[model samples]
Target: MSCAEESGRIMVGQEAPDFEADAFVKGGFKKIKLSDYRGKWVVLCFYPGDFTFV
Candidate 1:
């Protein structure tokens, strides 16, 4: 089975399935997978503010 089911609803308190995405690391960007950090600490942050120059 895939991470998301047909209904596309993930129940609360459930473990987040594995997924891949592009990430900025070491002065560059690379493809990363959530599972790669298994058994380790990981921080996921979301910025709601707009990027503007003053």
Candidate 2:
């Protein structure tokens, strides 16, 4: 998607939205709750695809 299509995206200094995801960590169950990091700054990130070269 182009920038305009994703223009609704927010950046730094603004309050982050609540998000949650289930993930496996150290071969055990893990729950990531965005709300848990409310007062902290987070580096939210991802790769479009892990094995593909950009």
Q: Report lDDT per candidate.
A: 0.67, 0.67
Which residue pairs collide in model 2, if any?
A: none
Candidate 1: where are CA atoms >4 Å away? 1-12, 49-54
Whole-model lDDT, candidate 1?
0.67
lDDT of 1 by residue, 1-37 (tens): 2232334556767666567777778999888877789
How well does candidate 1 match the true structure in TM-score terms?
A: 0.55
17: Cα error in model 2, Å: 1.0
TM-score of each: 0.55, 0.56
Clashes per candidate, residues 3 or more apart or on different chains:
0, 0
